[model samples]
Target: MTDIRRIWFGSMSKTLREAPLTTPNARKGLREGVHWRGVSAEVHLGYRKGKRVGRWLVRWRLPDGRYKQDGLGAADDGLAADGVETLNFEQAKSKAARYVEQERQKQQDAGKAPIPTVREVVEAYAAGRKARAMKQEGARPDDAKGRLSQHVLSHPVAAKRLDVLTDEDLADWREGLGAELAVSTVRRIVNDFRAALNGLPARTLKRLPATYPMTVKLGLKVGEAEPAAARDGAALPDADIRRIIDAAKAVDKAEEWNGDLFLMVLVLAATGARFSQVSRMLVGDVQPVQSRLMVPTSRKGRGQKRSTHIATRVGADVIESLRPSIAGRRSADPLLERWRHRQEKAKPGARPEWVRDSRGPWKSPTEITRPWAAIIEKAGLPVDTVPYALRHSSIVRCLRAALPVRLVAQLHDTSDKMIERHYASAIVNALDDLTAAAVVPLVDAERGTVVSLRG
Candidate 1:
């Protein structure tokens, strides 16, 4: 008994706005499109393959030739047969039907084109990026790009819109993908969406979610300082770190032609330094007096000109690991020159184009993920863990020891908030040890209810 009318400025049906299957007993083509107020509406049978099923599914073709479909499947009367639905027929379709009419009344009469949904926008954006990147470099992004798009952008969570993203939405998504995908999967999705927002030029960019909504849901982390930091793609643990290092050490030429891939990871694990820091460090950047390695400010992170500090433990490890090739070299030497030279040389020679420096430049952090990932897989470690996790692990260790996150962030060169969001509960166990160390002596030496402590 729903009112059905034709929507048109003239003789043409123009667009079918409300294609409603009003009742479980409704007949399509019996009533065709109906109108509410000045708007026209109708319901069309949605078909799947050869099966013509009657469900809540309807496509509202607005005036400007644009359309939006009701995803509700034909499972219920007047629903589509696709097995994908936003609403079920018998119960949800009628309610959905009302909106169809409302939309026509509000929009179609204006002769305006319909706006695209979140799914359409994301598809367009991703496809747009793919086209641009292909044309710009005549190639795809490095391997990290492969992992991200395949797992994060194209999977179940990809179509979620920024406005629709909720904590529950992300949490459910994180758990759903957790078993099938790597931790990096979620991280990469977050990064992809974030990059899409930040990197793409558009007025709608600001409306996107600034961080992965799951950051809070995955559990809190112990950062160098903050109460939260979002976890990333994946990171190797200490054992895997050791394994990767050993495998690299045993590679064909661990010496002379350094295994830049493994060595870079080792350096990140030990120093928690960002890729730019590890790559750009010159022999002279290492100061024995300060026990620090100074590199230029990175374009990533804070985006300011400042030095990144590599802790003594991490710094010493990198220096010792790289000592063989660098021992007799002068301060003018680049720390990573030899490795870069050897890697680029591994490919077939097209003849030498000398720019004076055999090691042309150190790689950015983003470029270092691929071969290191290969090394991890070869070493029988999880393929998901990447180099940045080294910094997180290092931060985790420091956090467990009750080292302040402020100090950790200061040392590691990232935000404290980023640390806390990603670190796991295992950090509590680490912190417990520090707490125990703090209290054990006090408990043992108590002369009164509480012993006086030295200032």
Candidate 2:
């Protein structure tokens, strides 16, 4: 049993009370429920004919002047049934007010257009970049798609609506990633995100977030020494280079390694060109008369063309060996063609021989890793050594031979600052030899003076 009270409903006053389901007055309405005037609606205590407990329901007027109804739960019974709790008269009134407010908000939201998600924007940007890359001639593979899918789209932040994205949300995501990724790698990914965001259509995103949380924050000043790993990898010693080259030659003789693989090692050791640059060289770029090799632009920079002299005898010899294979091809043809795979040779349309044909350029020098690793292992060199180490070794050789850093930088199409940073210790060692040549005579002269005095 519950007390009866008088309550106002919009403009009219009504009697409100809670009563048993069997009361004749409770069944007077067509809906068959004991209804009470609530804060924003008429709260009803209703029963289905066969149910033990009655449910609380609310009927309210929408902004459009249409009546809407919703069920809150069973009426207050003190005990919870099957994990469903009942609400009292006061609780029903509060719930009804909340229901009405929620309905109004839903209606307001329905009137506006939907916003894009972070993932949707990223995906659109990636698709656009991929399409542009495909349209360009000789475009390198676009890695942005893979990177965004793996690092950005997979993140929880991708679920956030684009319009509601804030700097704090981005900062939290960045901070979370900082625990697992290196600062440099995080900076690269963040820059990738910025690039993606900038690529979005002006109509889609009018402006970027105020703060880019993943920007590098190492506090490093200009001219500060970079971490050793950032500068370069370990340079191969002369002994290791010799051993590896000899092993590659032996492997070629044994028919386990391709002749081109051996020549690639020799050329890399001689010219100091990056793997990508060397892999993309065209036969016409080689000039035996001038002893120069015109290196094309690669993925390193914005594809700036550079020319480097093939001063080493080994480089000249390797170039001569490759001349026979490239003699008849057009100047635009790739110098190094992709080797025929063993499995491909057995295919129906396979070529009769494995000679270098005009099929096209090898996609990358990195594809030669299988044979390169075998040769390194056979030579007992460090297993961790990579193809880039050959370039480092070549540069260090020039430094040791007293070559000027300016000439080396010009040859490699890089800055003298880079050479000094990576090979400073080697340069210092070379200077010691120059200093010894001058100091040794002074020491000999002093020794002679001491002998003459003793005599």
Candidate 3:
């Protein structure tokens, strides 16, 4: 009593005759639907045509008379979706079936609910989050939202929804990066992905802690070496220290007019400042004064509570040799220009362009460190060291010279906790010297010979 017809997309069609929902072809992308007389019950299913085909069908009725079955797109997607059950619409069908069966089992026993779809979590993360949070702040979307677009929402993973995401899928997306991206890059993406998924009810997204782990353990780091110990205050060993200084000097002497490499190592050894802090300074901060400029804004001095001066104790000789004269200019001006003029005059054979851009201007901290390690290698050092280690070297030098801890902490721009974490071993070694200082004989009475008792 109802009209039956075929709906065609491309060269294919779904008809009352060929619908998989009511036919054996229903195994994979086989289209079948039946139109009954006077009633609106119809069946439809799918067919996927590849080397190994897949079929899945769903049958449900609209409470209204507009009844039909669900496997429409799979039949013609043209691949044997069965080859990858987790990928096709047919896979979604199988997933829904398992979910339904599980829900029934739950109902018969105690009480539990089906995991919500990935689409559900996504909508909530978007509406309940991104949209409102960005607008409510009355600003454009911040970096979090920007990263979200790249990691999810716009990725295939987002298309599937959160509940359906497996650790494998996350790994695939991450590994697909063309080359080896930095750990920091992978870490950032995972951070954004987790924030989105975790916005769902805790019951929904499983192993939020485990997502980050999968990226490190399962995919990227399978054969990577374990990192050497890194503490906030770890110093470069003395040999490495000497190597870095030697490399800097050699590199400078080869191109004496340029202070870029020379001053970097000097600050590194003298202050134990991070490469970032040293490189960011204009020529002004590297003042050729007797003291290192422990700027409040410096990475090493960023969090200090008061004016803290770390005595570089480099002495007037080194200061006068390197200090830039301002021609009555303020200390606020950068120091590189003076080095540039001197380098040009000293290396009269070298062009300005040749020396100025050794690795280029406004070099990033990491950029400086990369070559620093190279220079150390050229200088014949066995171990690689970074700029921050110089800070560690400085700390040890101070402790060895016996500067006060509270003063060291303030100068280093960190709490004693950070210093203790990094320099505990060096500090421990200094204790023997401290004990020696305390052993001076405490004279008893005016006439008594110096009697050795616990002082």
Candidate 4:
């Protein structure tokens, strides 16, 4: 038999404190609200719609043999509850008792509040994530905001309240996204939206269909198709790479673009570094004496905030070409720089008006795309080839040279797992020659026959 006295607290703070009602996890298995015996009524600590702060309600037995209930205040779950507005367990019980004593006389009832919409939740989630990212060392908060704004906030389902949102509604919206976006892009958007939903109250989250709330057990199905980078046209041949570099030099020389496109393309190929990483390199990052270039850590993905560099060795001739950029310049000077310009409206064939001379580091990777298109065109490469192909080609070159996967990963500033995942074909080709040395000739000594197994 269970002790009724142990289940209910009466004028005792210790009883309320010791009960499994303090933490969210502890109260998860309990009913909607945990009750305690209060003066002339029962004090109930009610959990909210989501994992938000708990609320307090007082239930009284009326003389007509009916129960009357009214909300008192919020329970102190996350924030410390003050006696008047927010109340602790003991304070809540006392307040509930007081409210019941007064309310039982008048028989008053509390009205229900409005529920939050999906858009509201997503906005709050984005703001909180952005703020935390600003404080954290290496978090990409802008990416989070971008995903939510472009996908969730713009969707029709954002207007639907959590209480009314159904599995079908979520599926409709997700499918709509898939219709316009790539499989990989749709997957990322769905993931980001799911992360935003995690901030909702536990109860509301539970109300969502187990499979459709983007939970792994019952989530939306995304295709596991091979990445575009794994295709045959992803990487350029070594002959094409050389031609591209030569063509870049020709374009820069003829167009008088100050060798910016040429140097940028050279460093990108030599280091196998991303455009963003190479654009951030300083004059001091180029070590002429050591024939190496130090690429900085990327700000795109999640990692530790580091000032360290990934040292990549290049040819002596490559280092020689970089020496002129370092001549009589500060170590902090950008290695590859260009003259910044604004498109001023010119009167029919007339020279454009003057703007400020701002020679600084490249602000974005998009700045190089136009020049890269021209370089590729001059090199007679495919029109569809992107600058990212250089990174793929570089990784393939190292794999072709029989460099260890771990060593290649270190130089390229990515994981061996990623390299293996994207470049397995290149890896298999490298292994074929390496495994050839271990092969031994077969002998037929038992049959007293001399035959070559090499055949």
Candidate 5:
């Protein structure tokens, strides 16, 4: 019943004497005892060194009558180094069947159907975004590439073929990422991935997967009560603000401090400008006569320049104080000089010098982070308080002063909706002030019964 001529025992011939021994077929490279035939492939069973060896060696005949042989995999039992189950005889047979089915399907699929992977789609989307960004003035090329690198390309699901991707696969990926990343961050990344996949052209792939399942939630469900408020920095209290300002002034007077640290903090509080926006401000951007400061186009502005009025008297004072330093400087010179550490020599033990540096009116804001942190620590402020808190404090103060939300939004170059969402507490305080100022309490002469009235 078995083919003895197709089996070769090799070194196990003496040990496997009870089993059938035969010569290998030079044409097929197949040594076999019993070869099982699938619809279009064959699985060979044999022996080597007295141990049973098997493999799925596909032998299919094309329409032209020529035969093609493909060695699928080893059919013997073994464990992979990663501990995943290796293909056994039965599994190999199943794989052989699937391979043949895939081949048949490929023939029906027009012979050249492209099966692009998730990685390919992500790459294509990133490239398209980069090209579009390059066309726009002041657009950073690395922004698109960074989003892909951080959110989509590094994901394990990126290796999966697009045609076979399922909602379950995406859900699993989200679940895994949820373990390491914040839920909001995970949601954003997942949405970005979905957007990238959906943005792929129809001709590039067969079909896109379903939408992402989990919506971003800021609060826990009924059974789970965890603080889920979106933590986007806080408005510094007036006491903390005063303390920080004092500390910055003290640091400015220090021997090692080479730049105007106090002015930076004062500018952020007075104008509600981002660190980068303030750092990039030129000496010419300050208009003391008009009482206005021109904030250049930033990434947040989508590259459109905007102007903010100097709303506070203290702000005017701060600008006037800095005018003398920038008097002899060109309009293209930076209004504020940033400090950098320079070594006297290239040697490792050389003493460092603190030098002021500027780039054609643009001073880098990152240079101030270390000194700002030290000042914050020395001021007895919260360790978590950041430089951006100064802007938040300015916004809250403006809102609490009963300034119109639209006007405040215009001053910050942001939307009223953003102010309402981020400074709701300040809005409430302003409302309280309005009620106190407008409403009057009436008292009866005898009983002292009070009634609040408003015109």
Candidate 6:
């Protein structure tokens, strides 16, 4: 029993004659019998001047600081409670709770503001997001708006009342999404919808049923092994990685690209940092003394964007190759910058084009596509091979090498849970390799062992 109920029972005498409101004498001695708090209502026993029985009364406190009162059945005094004509303390509290909920529902129906629908909640959330993002520069509020418009705004569930939404309704919608969308995409949609529900106004949220689906209940994992195809498809062999690096150097030399392509590709392979992160690196970020590279993270999610760096260990050869890029450069200068090429109309009314070229830091990943394509062609890699494949290969290499998952996650700037979630098969294989030594034969004839060694 709960502590409050325990106190109610423990405080009473065993004989029941002296227990609170159990006997005729106990009921007549007091003006009011006893009271206890329910969820949002309170139940009290009403006593008469000379009767052995009392009536159960419930009081509901409203938002306007007013209390609404109602009568339940008679409190069990001389007879046992059947939950109909008479009620025990526990039954009375339960009945009062149900009554309060019904009254609240009635008030909601009659109020000026109607109960919120899925569409309303999602739109409000998107609007609020945009308003908040306006106060903080660079925040992308349209992400939520775009997702909701595509997945929810046109769906049937969007018109349904939030409080009446069933689990099956949500499950059906999620299952339907799996037919046309990737598992990761469905998971993102569900998470975004849940965030919208949570972002609703406090009054609207209070009206939602407690059992509403606020999270994806079905298996949203990419697959049984979870994204194994994507992981396997993106990763390359160690030999291929070496070939790519060599090809990058050769392409830079042949194309007169100023070694920027080779160095950028080298840093990406060695550190496994994203293109955005690598683009933000400065000369001081290259720690040749420690043989490490301090790469900045992209901080993709909500909240204040703070500059965070992950110190990734690299080989001495990588550090040596990076020194030439950093040599004679200011500490704050971009580590890998090159001349930018652009074209503009020669005049407002003329169709002729003018070359507008200047040198500065790399502003976009598309800037490297030309050099990357040449490198891929030189290495004889697949036409579909992307720069991000290098990151996948780097992570797989670390896992196959049996590096600790925690350390690998640190180097990749992600959580161990994320690592396991995305690379379950790789992690399982690594575990198998780690535990291979624990397997021993039960019998050893060469040692002349006899009988069982088991305990």
Candidate 2 lDDT (Cα, 0 to 1): 0.63
TM-score of every candidate: 0.44, 0.60, 0.45, 0.65, 0.60, 0.60
What Cα-based lDDT does every candidate model obtain? 0.52, 0.63, 0.51, 0.72, 0.60, 0.72
Off by over 4 Å in 3: 1-243, 255-257, 283-290, 296-314, 325-330, 337-361, 369-374, 440-455
> Stretches of candidate 1 above 4 Å error?
1-179, 183-187, 190-255, 258-270, 274-276, 295-334, 339-357, 362-393, 396-402, 415-455
Better of 3 and 5 by TM-score: 5
Error of 6 at 159 (Å): 4.3
lDDT of 1: 0.52
Best TM-score among the predictions, by candidate number? 4
For candidate 6, the per-residue lDDT at 359 reads 59
lDDT for model 3, please. Answer: 0.51
Tens digits of per-residue lDDT, candidate 5, 13-57, equal 211122222322221344444343333222232333213544445
lDDT (10s digit) by residue, model 1, range 26-92: 4434343322222224334332221344433445565665556654444443444332353444344
Per-residue error at 304 for model 2, in Å?
A: 6.4
Q: Report the C-alpha displacement of residue 331, candidate 5, in angstroms.
A: 3.7
lDDT of 3 at 330: 60
lDDT of 4 by residue, 1-455 (tens): 11133223333323322235545455455555444343432434433423555676666656554556777777666667667787766686666655554454233322433456789888988898778767744233366778878877888989987655655677777777747676777877777777666677775554444432544223344557646457324888989989999999999998777878789899998888987788878999988888989998776557685656898899997898888888999998888898887767889989989654678776667787888889989999889999888998989889988999999887888888888888889899989979987786566779877776553
TM-score, cand. 6 vs. native: 0.60
Better of 1 and 5 by lDDT: 5
Question: Model 2, 151-259: lDDT tens per residue?
Answer: 8888898898754565565666666564576666666677677766555565444332322222212111112223745333478888988888788787766764456
Residue-level lDDT tens digits of model 3 in 84-179: 443354454454454443333444434555555444554556565555544432122335555556555566765653334466776676666546
Q: Ranking by TM-score, best first? A: 4, 2, 5, 6, 3, 1
